[model samples]
Target chain A: MRAVVWIAEGSWQACVDQARAILPPDTAVTLLHVAPGDVEALAEGARRGLFGRHPPPPPPHGSIREISDAEAGRLLATARERLGRECETMARRGRVEREVIAACAQADADVLVLARDGERKLGPPSLGHHPRFVVDHAPCTVVLAWAQAPPAVETIPPPPRHRP
Target chain B: MSEVVALLALALALAASVARVRFAPDWAVAVAGALVLLAVGAIGLTGVGHALTRFGPTVGFLAALLVLGDGCRRAGLFDALASVMASFSHGSARRLLAIVFAVAAATTAVLSLDATVVLLTPIVFATASRLQLGSRAPMYACTHLANTASLLLPVSNLTNLLAFQAARLPFARFAALMALPWLTGLAIEWLVLRLAFRAELDVAAPQDAQADADAERRPLPRFALALLALTLAGFVASSTLGVAPVWVAVIAAAAITIGVRPRPAELVAAAQPAFLAFVLALAVIVAAAGAHGLSSAVDALLPHGDGLLALLAVAGVAAALANLANNLPATLIILPLVSASGPGPVLAMLVGVNIGPNLTYVGSLATLLWRRIVHAHDETVDIAEFTRLGALTVLPALVACTAAVWLATQVT
Candidate 1:
């Protein structure tokens, strides 16, 4: 079996654990992370903010793209550790949903795994619009991982009114 | 026939400028529209020159402000401030949120809305990410406060500056009149944001992690803070001395440039020529629109009277127009009509344009820029979700601020 696992900015340990348990030992996996294509937008915005009616010159060193590249690399590396030896990693640049669908098609994977809401968890099983877009458009079996639930009450520490 | 063609060009240019599909940069679309207007003889060179003469100073002021803001950002001033604010959270998400609000409000009030959007958004995002807090609350706060907190002074937003000059109010007088509205709008925005994000704020984040990381990488530069204080003092002093605010901004930026000696490339990046083109093009388009029909339509719709109710009506109409065509262009279209409506109506319209943009992404360039910044950080805020939040916050803010402005008018 071949799998394309989409790793975003939040916890996807559930998806990784499930992939581990379910995939055959020889399963081929592709780990994909899509950085948004809004870097130019940000640069323009920064320009507008900094210079009201001035033209923006070429960006400086340490552009957001560079930072996002490092972030994507870290995310892919962490995902690879979770998926183990059968995985190859890719970090593409574009809209999250479009890139995920394209990645799955490129890999010709039978299954796609992604977190429903990559970050913000509001105590429900609702998915982010991007993940839902992938689920609707992707040409593969899709797995939606819920955010990791909090510790059980018995294991949790008593709530304090304020931080120490 | 040329009129019809010019109108088509205008519509196409406006759509292309803000469209999701990027055929060219936004500035290119705007410039193309302006050129088309000239090509079609819809506006003569004299008309273009006239528009430029009237609108040019505001653009120059914005550029100067950007130079100064970019200098501060390059100096690590924004980052240091973010670190300090985050440190106070001390692991509590609610406290962190409060700090974000306070910082965003103060930054917007003092430096201008774009300054808050440009300098604070990324730093706040990093702070949230580093602390294991979801980026939603802090991110939203940056955009929301950029608009809501911007009514404190004429310099706080481009719309305010336009109205300030039109109303011919002195700087201190403008601030005194707006202080109440600014406070009320901010209070309403805070209440709405807090209620909307209650669940998100309840999450326990790893506190002080960002502060530790930030401290090691770039310790707070005390000189940056000193420069900022000195720059602010220049603003007040120049206002009292009856000097053009732009001179103060330019002088302060030059001083910082001398002391900081940032790279030429850094300065250029901050200048953002494309945006300047967008502003210039938008002005020409509005002028064309005015010449063609938009002005007559607005004049008809513009409420007439000096009563508080009349001012509210004018504000209501301005806010609606702002959400439809954007605040900057809306201000341009409405400025001439409102100038005759007395300072109360003009200030009320300012309130509308400033606070009303929170309702939609396209309501202001600043909001659009905020959206881009958020997306660049790899976080997504759904349009529906954003609107719901905006609707809850903006209406109350508009009402409260407009009422306050009316009260100020009565007093003054």
Candidate 2:
């Protein structure tokens, strides 16, 4: 009977704020984040600089340091501030969508709820196309809940799957 | 004199084909080689007596085919048919069956069966590759169906027209014979192919997971819509007016060539090798009649109430020979022969040949085109593999049709 809420990648505060708004009182929420690392996708790339084009423009530099008790505690703080003391939060880290799917299966969760800045919505990396895949392979139904309010319209009023 | 020359030339052409099979090249392949030389000799020895135009039925047949096939292609009329087929197939065998059925059925209805196969072959190959649906089912099915379906309509097949003319049967009666073969052959084909490739059913779907478009050409299959319409209209008119099938060809070709910047050899191309073969057969048969005892003998044999079985046997043998040794010529050769066999049996035989070649790769011109299309896409399919799948379907269908024809003979 577990319902898992995933805090997808974005402004930690904005996503936390939305997650808090959706969860019921006393619900346990898992705070997830993609740990920063040089995930050289191609082991070959790491072993031998796999590209001739000079190293990709350096990833932006700034204060990405831990903000609270747990490294992801900063996101949880934001969620708690928005939702109040009713929900218990714990931080977990991995690839956003992949981790969410695996975690949902492990938690025996009924649904995987993720918050999207109406714009960060190309969809959870591989998990979005995975519904049909899951339908094909998963033993249970997957409920994909996304924040529909389109990002550009400021008012945060009506909802939609995509802008158009 | 012209008759003598024509007969002589035909004999030489036959000899030349034989030499090619034995030694080939110089004697067999040259333009002045045995075949054409004989044809030329036939023309020169006597010449067209009082003839203003040398190509009568030939030219007319060509023109009509081009006009009709071109016009429909222009309209995007058959463009949608491909997608419709892709949707119908449920799995490997069914999908392949659908592809073959679509090509065969379409060939029977609109374009000449060979042209129909040519037109649809590429589409079939593309669909197979795009879907990554393996098993030689589609290729064999397309070829078999093309050959089989060609017998359904008069305008769709030269053999049908000759039989129709020879028999002097009404439209309704001719149509009645058509129904049984087309449906039965298709069913038998499906069943055969299913059994042939039953082992391949669990074959995998493409992992790429994308909609694929193989070899679709535009401005070609597109702009020919007008020609297609004219061609069909010609067929409909032929039935109504009782004009020779050649008249339909003349009108169709003229409609295409009139003051337009026609694509170079485009009409000829679309009228197709298969269609041209039929035309050539017609010319050859006409030439052979006087010398070959084709007329009186054929007359004596046909229009018989008691000789139905003999007549059917002749027509059936002629069609099978046509399928084996070039269907077009076989058709032409047999047309006069069957005039004696009577039209009912003759028409039934044409129907049989139309569908019979589904048994082998080289059985029909349409099949060769379908094979070419599949290969052109870098897709590999061997004849043995094709025949294997076909045997599963074609033999049964042929047997069932044989019974149907026998029963039909009794009914009449």
Top candidate on DockQ is 1
Question: How close to the true structure is residue B358 of candidate 1, measured as C-alpha lDDT?
Answer: 77
The candidate 1 chain A region of ten consecutive residues with least summed lDDT is A50-59
Candidate fnat values, all: 0.10, 0.00
**lDDT digits (tens) for residues B1-412 of candidate 1:** 6556556655565555445335566668778888988988888899899888777777777767777777777677787776776677776667878999999998898778877776677677666655555556777788878888899877788888777766777777888899999889878878887877665565554324445644645567777677778777776676678897777767877877876787887776676667767777777877887888778888898778867778778888888877765677778889878887678888888888887777864455444654566466654323555678889888887887889998987888
Off by over 4 Å in 2: A1-164, B1-55, B74-79, B89-96, B165-173, B202-238, B241-261, B268-282, B289-308, B364-382, B388-396, B406-412
Please provide TM-scores computed only on chain A for all of the candidate models, following their numbering.
Answer: 0.76, 0.46
Best by TM-score: 1
Model 1, residue A50: C-alpha shift (Å):
11
The structural similarity of chain B in model 1 to the true chain B, as TM-score, is 0.89
Clashing pairs in 1: A50-B66, A54-B272, A54-B273, A55-B272, A55-B273, A56-B272, A56-B273
- lDDT for residue B275 in candidate 1, whole number 0-100: 74
